[model samples]
Target chain A: MCTTCGCGQGEGRIEGDEHPHVHEDGGGTVHSHAHAHDHAQGPGQRRMVQIERNLLEKNDAFAKINREQFVQKGIFVLNLVSSPGSGKTTLLTATIDRLKPRIPIAVIEGDQQTTHDADRIRATGVPAIQINTGKGCHLDAHMVGHAAERLNLPQDSVLMIENVGNLVCPSAFDLGEAHKVVILSVTEGEDKPLKYPDMFAAADVLLLNKVDLLPYLEFDVDKCLDFARRVNPRLKVIRTSATTGEGLEAWVEWIEVGAHSAKVIRGEALSSPPCRA
Target chain B: MSLMEGMLRIVEENARDQGFGHVRTVILEIGKLAGVEVEALRFAFEAVADGSIAEGAALQIEEPPGLGWCVECEKESPVESRYDPCPLCGKVPLNITGGTQMRVMALDVE
Candidate 1:
């Protein structure tokens, strides 16, 4: 029950204007979305049950299922996260253009409305599926699970999942991706890593995009790196410019290493027994 | 629909498992740094809880303070956000220890 135009008020249409209703778990998200408080309250005394369970447990459960699917299918999934207009879509297109032929690649794009990003990925001649979260601010594992199923990414292929542009909520939701790559443009505040520490801590890598504009802007690269390192000591930082393709090579190398490592791990798992997380 | 819906679904399933048809109150434990807006969650509950076990449930939110481990001070500090400098050392990026929780801690059910 997610509406595209109006925020989460109703379900949204899919890519084309023709066929809509591609929401995840619409079949039974809640078997009783139409549940009205019609049941009689017959001496129902309130009692407390200490559930002590995270609200994202359901999403994490779906994420585990997604992780298993990725492992079994040997697909390398990368969740791209960033603030809006951080040049996430541009980076995805550039990455796709560089790596699509070398290794089979497919993209799952998330946005509030329209098929713009998905259409851009498709322009590079790769399968791109757009998931409109409608009023949802982030892409949860449940949605990604269904999106992956629909994309049907090939074995040993790279699956880039561009999360909805928001550094806040996306950090908490795991989409079963091998890694969460967070992009921060130089134009944005250099202290974002500190400001949004959860996102920095959750991210596996930080892409400092729009580095070409660094010369013009007062963005302090060193400070940003220091802040990122402070938040996550192990976070790998990469500077990139999708327009000039300056740091795309190093980014490509990083992707290749990640994809290869994911494949190898999947291979090892296949050779041995699967380890349940 | 992603988070709150999932939560209500679990609550309903729990109600079925425990034979409680009605939820009187939902005491949600949300950390200050949990990145969730309680107001939005309440809105989601209003939208998705209709006819479910939690339809008429009262939402009681418990916001626990954020806990963080400071490296320089080598101590745990109460942090409201990651941006908050270490309470002890005044250093940024304290490892979050608490207050990032987004869970159903306790539910007053019938």
Candidate 2:
């Protein structure tokens, strides 16, 4: 009999008093000191099996790969993050229109459910891909990976990823962009950076959108800038109004400079930044 | 967020792959700066786990505080969120060392 399977003890092993035993009446009687070994092994195995950390490690690794790929391609990618109705789409549309006929641009639009922003970008005659995330509040590396496959972006083009209109979830996932451009409209509130600091903290550039509405609304621009700076002192802040095309030229110039810098860093070209936009 | 939900599904699949009949408890490790709400995740787990192996599982969440290394300050500082400035020296551009995570660490099964 196999002792390991609790069958009759092996022929060489007698049903001996050497082993610890538990009675059927729920009372246990230890016959040997070796029983302590079994007690220690159980907790030891548990400690070895338990792992702590985000299971999204795989996604993060993929994001790093995507970032390297983007850098190698010399494409300047910007991840636009903001809340719903924050003028992100409008700003992109205005920027695209201002920079068109000079800068080769493309867009990857992420939304919970809609092709609306993609349609708006397409109207500018630039190639665009609409990623409807369904119920997903954020765009992960996997989704961006799929979008990259579909876009087939030019080696020198500017790729702007308009993340899902969410301040929280989108900030957590890296889409392999060179910069995180966070858009906060004055209509949202001055304390937005403090309320959702992660988004502001992750931002490489902060755009104060819808500044044209500042006069009519009670939104304080200086307070918002001060708060944003406190959260991230190194953050670059740009104020713009998509409606009046205010500050758009500087925005376009910024992208052109970034693209040129990326190209030069990659040894692609010594070409000057586009001057038309 | 659905990312967290998808992560939980993967955990369930992994449990099933191990021949688990049901998952009674799940130990989840979520970083402080992962931008996930523990209570909201628990509610989402309850809703998403319905009819699955995790249907009745109790969600145990562990949140580790965020840690950042400020290049400007040249030291490590503990932070509550990603936005918190360096404690020793108020500065921007702190490199995040840890606490931006979301994962299922362990499970209890019968």
Candidate 3:
């Protein structure tokens, strides 16, 4: 399976690439070195070159650039991740309704295919851009960088990136956000944390959504929280329900605190002189 | 697929920098806690690297065991899963200290 999408190994086509195929090596070597000359020096003709670079080094570099830009602009960015139908959009719209009066906000909505979520966000009177991943599952740092550039996100504002609806893929890709918020609804199984440990482990906050429906369900809240904590000890959880407007205050306040910190960082950066080494 | 493409891009970049025409093998150091599925990576690499400089290149993965520092036992223990508690004390969450490596350690090029 592809870690980014959970698609079948030999089935799905990755972005900008065709299906896996073998090609004939038709003697394309341009070198004219004598094989016997190096044969005495090594056992094989292949030379070992050490790189010692991280696999995500390229993505991390892009993410670092995005992070620096966000910090400089005092933008508090949150990468919202969750399974589909976890009320991410509903919660986001509700949260925006509350925060928009006080703070400037922008959104980047990612989906496999749709301008619908972005349209919904725009309906809330905020700037939003939709990134259709096509066959891709998660939004990578490169895509986020391009989207951020296009959005021209304002300073001292909250930037919400609603990632592609998948509990698996988004956990590995960091989009230079200040935090990764994972939302799990009550309709889902409580053992989700244990089943998808990577997503729970990667998240800083877990929004236990659809708490309003808890009365009609057999979902164990304590067990769910415990399971999430077992995967990630410091994961802050907020019981939220967009329909009932429950826990919206705490969630909004949490965003405010983060946004305030970003503004403070910007203030400090403005006051300090650039250091030269 | 993204990871495989990233690895191929790195290889291509290094090929240009180091003056290598073809890659024979790509060595990776993948930790047990790196969240990478090796089988998936291997499957994706064939497609991602096809017709590229690393086409037909062999993937060699070196898996390192996950290590966690148990606060209750005041010792480090090998942990297979992240949710596992202190193997020694059987209580409290163990602080993950190792086995998150996901690096392209080396390459065999010609």
Assess every candidate by TM-score: 0.86, 0.75, 0.87
Q: Which 10 consecutive positions of candidate 2 chain A have the poorest summed lDDT?
A: A24-33
Stretches of candidate 2 above 4 Å error? A1-48, A268-277, B9-22, B51-53, B67-99
- Clash-forming residue pairs, model 2: none
DockQ of each: 0.48, 0.19, 0.40
Assess the local accuracy of residue B71 in candidate 1 as a C-alpha lDDT between 0 and 100: 81
lDDT per residue for candidate 2 within B1-110, as digits (tens), equals 35445545466555544544566778888888777778888877787677776788788888988898998878988888666778888885467788876777887765
iRMSD of all candidate structures: 4.5, 15.3, 9.3
lDDT of 2 at A29: 9
Backbone clash count, each prediction separately: 6, 0, 0
Of candidates 3 and 2, the better by DockQ: 3
Candidate 1: Cα lDDT at A56: 77
Give one digit per residue, the lDDT tens place, for model 3 in A1-104: 22321222232212223441111111110111112222122223569999988777766876887898899999999999999999899999999999999999
lDDT of 1 by residue, B1-110 (tens): 56677677668767755667678888888889877778988988877778766888888999999888888888998876666778777876678888888888778877
- What tens digits encode model 1's per-residue C-alpha lDDT throughout A1-277? 3331121322544453354444443321212233434444465666777787777776687688889889887788999999999999999899888897688998888887778889888999999888887766778776677667778788888999999899988898888999999999998999998788889889989999999998798888998898888778789888899999988989988888878887887888889965655
Q: What lDDT does the true structure give each of the candidates?
A: 0.79, 0.72, 0.82
Model 3: DockQ score: 0.40
Q: After superposition, how far is residue A146 of candidate 3 from its true place, in Å?
A: 1.8
Question: What is chain B's TM-score across the candidates, in the order shown?
Answer: 0.92, 0.87, 0.93
| TM-score, structure 2 vs. true | 0.75
For lDDT, the strongest prediction is: 3
In terms of docking quality, model 2 is incorrect
